[model samples]
Target: MNCPLQGERKGSVNRIMRELNGISVVVPFLNEEDGIRKFCNTIDKYAEKFDFFLELIFVDDGSTDSSVEILKQCAFQNIKQVKLVKFSKNFGSHAAIRAGLQYASYEISTWLGSDLQEPLELLELSYEKIREGYNAVYIEKKSIKVSKANRIFSRIYSWMMRKYAVESYSSGGISTIVFDAKVRKYLNENMEANSSIMLQAMDAGFKSTVLSMDFHERSAGVSKWTLSKKMKLFIDSFVAFSFAPIRLVSIVGVFIFCIGVVIGISTIVNKLINPNVPVGYSTLASITALGFGITNISLGIIAEYLWRTYDAARKRPVFIVSDVVTIKECESDTQ
Candidate 1:
């Protein structure tokens, strides 16, 4: 896992090139059959621009379509190395990426979706930054070509992450990331369910750089990130990394207790001043309902955190690879 340029502090572009070995590109996909071939071809085309070897690790997150079949076919292409890791079931993209990182063989690793929304040139930029001694390089999307509603949701999610999780959370989402083997090891060792890789990397206290790029429309296939999935990811990230929800619950509890105390004191004073003051049943009922609602909400948030803790303690494999298809340089020539 040692970097090709070990112990080299800073060097010119020529020196960096001389010391670089290769990069591992992890592409995690789910039911992206229509775009798999095009994606692989695009990677091969752009890969030739660099002199270093490229290892393509395609993690299939239980794709129901022929995505795996197409990947098997692409394995025979004129690529340096291609490995397909098929999951037993749909464990989600984050899990797929984690699985890919575990199997990545090169010093540097990056991830991209099967849909060609991100330009391949970003990979080159990431590599250059890694060569410049940065442990992690995250791609931030300056703008997206999605619907207005999607845009707003993205913004809100980004804002929440920055405010709650970390100030440096990538607004562009964690779909793409480039980091060296050192950072990769850290991520794998400290993996958590429903967590944000970008946030974790930023919190790793490493020297990192963010490169802003415009997100393009998908070339083929509709996006698989449904609304439910997005919401789940949001909750998972917050529960895993932020204590804001728990703290909010505590604050609400304290505020409610203070309000109750004030109400009680006011009731006693009014009763003493006017013995005929009748107790209002409606007010009592409303207060009771509010208490119940807040209690339930607080319990729910606590339950979420407890469940995540239980999940992490169990230490289940994020993804189970059902199959593998690998194409080596020597094997490709015979085919």
Candidate 2:
């Protein structure tokens, strides 16, 4: 997709009134046909109350359903423009959101999920905070009404991230974020695949404000966030931002080596004291297995960093856009 306010030759550019008082919203979805119309209607009602305009950028991340068709058929009230980006295949939600950011035109931009779990009020509140000179506004959930297992995972992940990675990361973890054009442009230009965009934005040292809010339960469509994908995100967040894991490997290696030294000394002293004692194979086998296990884990952590480096070196595109559709508004209507 083309960047905002540039002459386009490589990809198409869908023009909007850049000077309009508005916020651009990027909604990324996968197989959310059941909620498209309802989401649009809800946003429309919310937008009707705003004095500023709204730009909705919907990115379809390779949904094998009627989502695109339903999206195309839907209409919005009080929205300045509607842009749809259809990916060739499932490129992941972060990739989809990044794709939408490339086309953002307003002074402020934020992303929301198609499930409508996050309230539109968060966007408005974020806008106010951004106007107060914060470059980014993070909506941290006061309470997440997800499953017990998911909530536990979220808490652990959030704590780990704050402890080892970004110190300023939200305690409850971040889901919805709103940033001004400056941060948005920075994120768009500096894109890294297999990385957490939220973490990336936070690590950039931009002035950010966090709001403690409650997120609603999903009103429609099942979530596409699988456990394996969450694990990948966890690994990616650490690998991309923190060296704690690599440092941890070193720490564990040193610790294990010290223990081995102590054990060896004890064994030698025991042998000298009791020459009749037999060297136990069970003890040796246990030590061997423990050493191998630690070694493999250390190697695995190192490999994560190396693989990300190799992937970045290859300069692969984070996402491939197969199609783009823009619903334009009349010049008079924009005014």
- The TM-score measured for candidate 2 stands at 0.94
Model 2 lDDT on a 0 to 1 scale = 0.86
Best model number under lDDT: 2
Q: Each candidate's root-mean-square deviation in Å?
A: 5.8, 3.7
The lDDT values for all models are: 0.80, 0.86
TM-score, one value per model: 0.89, 0.94
Q: How many residue pairs clash in each candidate?
A: 0, 0
128-202: candidate 1 lDDT, tens digit per residue: 899999998888887768888788888899889889988878766545779988899899998777787767788
The residue-level lDDT of candidate 2 at 235 comes to: 97
Off by over 4 Å in 1: 1-20, 75-78, 171-174, 328-335
Clash pairs (backbone) in predicted model 2: none
